[model samples]
Target chain A: MFSWFANPHRFVKLSDWLVPACYVLAAVGILWGLWQGLWIVPKDDYQGGDIMRVMFIHVPAAWLAMASYLGMAVMSFVWFIWRHEVADIAAKAIAPLGATWTALCLATGAIWGKPTWGTWWQWDDARMMSVLFMFFLFLGYMALRAAMDTRQKAARAGAILAMVGALNVPLIKFSVDLFTSLHQDASVITAEGPKMAAVYLWPLLISSFGHTLLFAALVMTFMRAEIWTRRAAQLRARLMTGD
Target chain B: MSGAPILSAFRQALGEAWAGGAGALLPLGFFAGTTVLVPLGVGTEPATLRAIGPGILWVSLALSSLVTLERVFQADTEDGALDLWLQTGAPAAAIAAAKTFAHWLTAGLPLALLSPMLLLMFQARASGALLENMGLYAIGGIAFYFWGGVGAALSATVRRGGLLISLIALPLYVPTAIFGALAMGDGPSSASAPLFLAATTLFALAAAPFAMGAALRLAAD
Candidate 1:
């Protein structure tokens, strides 16, 4: 199935409609989520009161941050194994976006932390530290890719880094947990279920889904732009040969 | 089929490193220089130094290990030694392991041996436990080199990869440093820290060579 879209022309044709649809759905979901979260949801009695509104953005961004990397890693695996140009392009496109979401998660987390935990950054917090390292992992992938001279080499290198980082993500989380015992226990979002009321939970869920759609839309745009850029470069090379 | 090539590769790497005398000594010099600068920069207050002693030592080890990483593959690749190794039909990972062993022998081993004295210079109580400190540093230093070798291998084709190598390797080094430092400290937690530290080294030993081998192949290509 993925092999069918491995061709750039097919991918472009598919994404032309898919990207706009994703953007429209994302915009509606995000707008509705924001309205519901900001105005309709009541203030938390135990937590930061109205400031808890940031959770709608913060939680969704954090989820997408991890989700984007997982997506990149999967794309990287596809590229590494099949040598798919589209997969490589998709992986490369996801790096900066993933990094941005990771940053957004960190910034909003810090803002939320300042009020709730009484510190802007907590070194001992496993979630915060692991997320910070996740950001670094993304930076390292981008930097390694940028430093290489050839596209193939860069893609291969980036693929390997992404795979290694993906493997280490679990280890990093575990190590951080072991190295520091202090952590904010999952109160609202639990494995059993979300413990929050429907008003807050619905908005958070919608926002998380909206963020996923937005990320998909953005990735499609970047991948399309990458395809165009490569085409132009090929054309330029041909013109130079003709001259 | 035979161990001769691996042994020769290791010997050649070690001899080349030691001949410069600088590669062997550079990490030590860097370790000592950084240690000296810390007191001057942070003040000679013994209590403060004692508090941060293990952390400073690990950070110094990390930085010093990074100092020699660029040369792990740069010199070999530039001189075609890597190509010769690749042609030997020995797995690239095996060659990487041999080179990393050579690197550990020259750069990491010395830092491990000298860490006790350095710890004393900072008035760290770990000076009394020289054997334990040496053990921890040896394991931790090897882990550093193994992981750093991955970065060095990845960046082998890049021009002036020294800083880039550090940027690539340092994040990977975090677990080793954390576990190693924890092991060196005096507390209830110290018992488990060394075991975890050893686990980290084993993890690096298992993972890095394959990554390095792949990167080296790409560089050779």
Candidate 2:
């Protein structure tokens, strides 16, 4: 099956149909999640009653943001070793989306923290710094890629960085563990499973899945654009050569 | 060049710092001005200054390297001297070592010399902290430039490379900053940290030349 999808044209054809389906699923899932999280789920007694609901989207976005970078890092290794153009394009496409997800995480976290944690920001916290570090890494990666004059060179530079920046992924993940910080443990990726009640948990899962689907669909759309753009450039070059 | 790498590197560093016109001197000038500005801006409280002195020293070291890293191969690439370096019989590592040593001598050494003024400007009183921080900064500066040589090598192919050079160099710089800061910590220095710093600096020095050389070949290719 991996071999079957190895062809970019075949992958493009497959993604065309799957992309719309993913969008439909993502839209339905997100709407259902928001409705359940906001209207149906019970409020927390410790924090502001209704404010706790924001975790449905906020937590999922944070997870997906980090996940996307990890995904990009993996693709970078592939690009470096295999020299796959698709891998490079995928890595490039995920960066902005990952950055957006990171921003959403920070913004929503701040909003939630304002009522719960009693502040919008805290510096001594490892989690906050890790998030900031992720943001910087994302910006740095994007800047590095754009700084290059040619696509291949950019891809090469970006691939090396993505791999090296992989070092930061674990650092970000474990910062809360290693340091005495305000950031909480992994709610979803834990071994003992989620600690939240089923009512709150269900919406969280749906929203997280919805975001993942959305990310996949967006990446597919970007890949299609990149492939088309490259082909168009090639055609222009051919015409210039009077072929 | 056939003698010990240490002597050859030192000689080359001294010679190359003043080579190829005045552009090489720009980092030295920039380092001097920035160091002077630090003292002037921080007021004359010696104790207060000493507390923040190490941090400021490292910051200048990093920025000074940033200014000159572009020149490592930037002018050479533009003028085609880099191509000749690539084609030379000398090992790429030797050339990388020479360039790094030259970078440290011209950029890093001047920053180290100017650091006392900046520290004095902050009103640092402790001579021990000053000397220790100075030593750490000098060694860290050499380590930093070697890593930066990798960035410069990779960036030689780009037109406006300064921004990308910073992106690549800054992440690798965190450990140096951390160790350099820890080395100047309040009590007797932490045993682990200085050892770690020395090991990291040696690693960067030994490993970066090869990585940089490979990157240069890739850029050339």
Candidate 3:
């Protein structure tokens, strides 16, 4: 099944159908989650009412944002080692999407922090800076790829960069836990397991699923476009070389 | 295979980088500016001066080392010396190690040598603690430079890859930066912090070379 889908054309065909379906599901799920989170979920025992609601969006977006980058990084390794065209194409397509998710995570994090932490920004804290670092890493990766003129060379260089930069992901995850970090300790997700009650968790999971599915839909669409563009460029090069 | 080819290449091209002289100027200038000029510009109270000294030193290392990063692999690759290195069949890891060593020798060691002078310029008391903090910065700077090497190798071609190098590298430097500053903060005689810095640097030194070498091969291909 994996080999059958390895064909670029076959993958594109599959993505072409699923893309619209993903978008519809993502839209519905997001809407439903927002409605439940905003109006239905009760106020936190400690955080009062409005402040806790942001978690419905913030938590899910943050989770999916990170997951997207890991996905891209794994695909990048596959492209580098196996010379898998589809993997290469998928990674290239996912970069901007991953970057967008990172941005959303930061923005939502700030929105959440302002109400709870009494401040929107803090530098010395590892958690805040770790997220910032991930954002920079994404931008740096994209900028480096763009600067290179050749497709193969760009892809190879980008893959190496993504792999080496993987170290930052752990930094992002554990920054708060390990150091005298400024960000508050993990409220929901923890080694001991989430501290949240079921009412809050159910909506949080739904929103998280929504964001993740949205990423999947976007990545597949972008990869389809990338495959077409690459084929067109190859054809143009071939014709110019009279192949 | 014999190591003779790598040995000869190292002996010849080692000076190619040194010949540029920017490596020496970059770190040395920052060290002077931070340790000397900043103190002169600020108030003269010893307590205030000592408190800020550790931060200034780390900043100097980061800023000054950056100026030399663009020169890391670019000129060699452009002039085909890197291509020659590739042809020599030296292990990629060894080539990366040699370059990283050359960089540390020129950049890191110079900073180490300048530390006493910098401390004196800041009127930092020659307490045992002060000396230990200086040692931490010096050793930590070298180890941290290897991680920087990995970034330098990866982004060597980007138009403003120098800036990107810092972007990619700064996160990795966080633990080093935090630990280094805290080590110094604990006082010059406090051995624990500097020890941590040294230990962290050793970890970086061991791992970064092969990672950078892989990036070099990817860049070459």
Which candidate tops DockQ? 1
How accurately is candidate 1 docked according to DockQ?
Answer: 0.67
lDDT of 2 by residue, A76-140 (tens): 88888877777888899999988898899999989998998888988656676667667767787
Name the best candidate (by lDDT).
1
Candidate 2 residue lDDT tens string, B129-173 = 666666777888887898777678777777778877887777667
Clashing residue pairs in candidate 1, if any? none
TM-score of each: 0.96, 0.85, 0.90
Model 1 lDDT on a 0 to 1 scale: 0.87
- Across the candidates, what are chain A's individual TM-scores? 0.95, 0.93, 0.89
List, in the given order, the native-contact fraction of each candidate: 0.38, 0.18, 0.51
- The better-scoring model by lDDT among 2 and 3 is 2
The lowest-lDDT stretch of 10 consecutive residues in candidate 3 chain B is: B185-194
After superposition, the stretches of candidate 3 with alpha carbons farther than 4 Å from their true spots are A1-5, A171-176, A181-194, A238-243, B12-14, B20-26, B34-46, B158-160, B187-192
- The digit string of per-residue lDDT tens for model 3 on A1-243 reads 435656898898888789999999899888888999999988885763587788877778777667777887888888887778888788888888888878887887788778777778766566667767777778877877887778887788788878867754664445333455755577577898877788888888888888878889998988888888889998999999998
iRMS (Å) per candidate: 1.0, 3.3, 2.3
Compare candidates 1 and 2 on lDDT and give the better one.
1
**Best TM-score among the predictions, by candidate number:** 1
